[model samples]
Target: MNALMLAVALATHATPVSLEDARARSRDNVQALTAALQASSAEQDVRASRSSLLPQVRFSAGASLNYIGPQRSYNVVPVEGGGFQQLQIDTPEVRYPFFNLGVTVSQLLYDRAVWARLEQSGAQLEALRGEATEQQDTSELEGINRFYSLFRTQATIQVLEANVRRSEQQLERARALFQAGRVGKAEELSALVNLGNDRIAVVSRQSQLATDQARLSTWLAMPGAEAVEAVDPGVLTQAPAPAPSLEQALQEARTRRPLLVALRQRLRVAELQESIANAGYLPRFSLDAGYQRTGPEPSVFFGQPARQNRVNGGLSISWDLFNGFSTQAQARRAEYQSRVAELNLQQSERELEGSVRQSLVALQAQIVSAELAEANRKAAADALVLAEERFNAGVSSTLEVRDAQLKLTQAELTLLENRINVEIARFTLMRAMGTLAPGEAK
Candidate 1:
């Protein structure tokens, strides 16, 4: 039996993970990965846009065959004395094969629109980078929340199991008293009922622990079939640090928040779009040069006498004199979009401020609640000891002891919950302030 119990313990044991470790393992989170991919794509777009500013070189080669149908020609032959004789001649089919190779290079001398597009692409890249950071922050926060949740459930289950053991002890005591004729069978039955209820509560708590463990494991990208255990960071015994002033928090959020930075970048992009749209009002200039070789044969080998070589260079200018008022419409649309981006930025700022304030309040409240719960737990423990003593001395009934045990269980669970909440609230405030990072508390 001892060996069987040891085997069960070993089988059920889970490896403990910390919040930081869990977050490190969560790099493959879908949202974060998606954001990273988008950022990479935007980086490619920036490269493409910048390439447009450089000279473009192209090489082309082609071979073609031409054929014409048989032709009839009339020739007038001068006779010996006068132009009186006409002669008919037949011509063979005309067929030829031609080959050409060319190299061309073009450079844009002036185009405000192309420059604006490059600037826009650069701004877009910055925006995507900010979004990627925001996604990472979000994923880290989620991992922290799950980690604490699992910790809380595990602690609660411990308390529940202790309560079940206390109930069992109370039932045994009641049976002893009834056999000694010091208490009635009713008291024993009540104790038995309490034990059953406590056991039921334990079962429920264990189920909850299982569920929370699964959730945390999934968030950490661990195998779904494996169990994950959380190690208590002992926040319950330590005092929470005071929260920063609301003004300071708001400043930090504005300065460091990834989403806000992204919005600002997007606003720049929109402004650049407006410039690009208006660039159409000006003319564009470019220089192009080309070299070509043409021959009747498909070979360009060293200086074939039949090959023809040509070189050309030119400056080109394009001006859109009219485009059915499309440029005007585009400029107007860009302006509206710029306005929209500004409004979105402002709204996000307001929302972020609100979140920071709310998190601060919650953190303060949880800290105070944790303090009170600690005191309550201590008092309940003393009460339980006294009740047990009175029951053993025959001065109090088993009911009093059971009630004390229940109160102590509640107190312990409450303290555990409040401590977990304090930690979570602290991290939440950090997230809202945009300072959340792996393994580090703001």
Candidate 2:
């Protein structure tokens, strides 16, 4: 099948795509990219949360102009050697400019909520990473299924075409025998019918191939008219490696499956959220320091000696005290969420165990089927040869030979199909066990 795909690719001068290429292309899959982006965003959230534990510095500057109206002033002026006299004066209008520049620094001395949030964010990031990996695996599997399905259809078409050619040859022989009076009209008619059926089968197989190719093009993100050829991985003909016992597979899945790992991380994240919620009942403390300069001009920040300059530092604590029972309600909700996460993890484990068992059984059954199919194909080939010899020697009828030919074709197709099925089963079992290679498409 792989050879056929490569041949088609070479004949058409189209770039041949292998399973590895499909897996690589899966990196650009939309769902995987979205998960990766989510992971990246979560990482930023973690950084932002952790930043609360570090000192933060901010610098600010402002300038304002104030206009003042004329003011009346009262004063007592003293005479040279007499009593003081009262006087009145009107002051001119004036404009005043104010400017200030300051830098403020704050550090989180102790805040349980911020610390809990940081921990939660880290766990969420890990969960998103796992999700991204899952999406990648899913995309790869989708591409692989499409590729192999197309391969299967193409192979079937090849078989049907060969069958049609064989039937045509048999029909010609039947017609010649009929004219020579060695066979009757019925035999020739039967041969014609067989040839027509084989042609129909070829048409059906071709249609199936076209459909599979169209689906594969969607996975490859190519134009509808683009040709895609899959590399034959030779998995159908190769003997698979020994699989582990059911118990071993389950154990491996428990430790290695990305979904399980991600779920565990989510559980931890939920626990951290609960902690964060409970933290609302506790007091938060921090340290703050600032330096400031103020004057009538922007230059007062640096050059004006008359500018007021000051530095201040302080420690602060905030206790929520009460918020109309909202804090208590949040704590309860978080605890409930934690419980739900635990339950979900348990459910996932149960489902995963079932899947592993089912896949193992299916793989074992398909292996047996492949062995039987091979034996059947050999028997059918022998039968066809014997029947053809009998017909040539005039010891048996053409109907017997035609039946044997049909049986041989069916047996060949069955063997090939079963071989592919076994390969698919092997892949499924590996996926269930969480042991599939990173680069290999499912």
Give residue 413's lDDT in candidate 2 (0 to 100).
89
Model 1 lDDT per residue over 100-127, tens place: 8899999999999999999999999899
- The reply for model 1, stretches above 4 Å from the true place, is 1-13, 65-69, 73-89, 176-181, 298-302, 305-307, 438-442
Which tens-of-lDDT digit does each residue in 1-442 have in candidate 2? Answer: 5434544543384446777777677656776778889989999999999888998999999888999999998899998898998799999999988888899999989989999999999999888887777676667667777877877876777777788878888888788888888888998898999888877777656556557767787677777666666677776667655556898878877876777778989999999989999999999999999998888865655587665888999999999998999989999999999999999999999999999999888888888888898899889989988987787665777689889998988988898788787767766776666665453212
Question: On a 0 to 1 TM-score scale, where does candidate 1 land against the true structure?
Answer: 0.90
TM-score, every prediction: 0.90, 0.88
Each candidate: RMSD to true structure? 3.6, 4.6
Q: What is the number of backbone collisions in each predicted candidate, taken in the order shown?
A: 0, 1
Off by over 4 Å in 2: 1-15, 71-91, 175-181, 240-242, 297-302, 438-442
Model 1 score (lDDT): 0.86
Q: How many clashing residue pairs are found in candidate 2?
A: 1
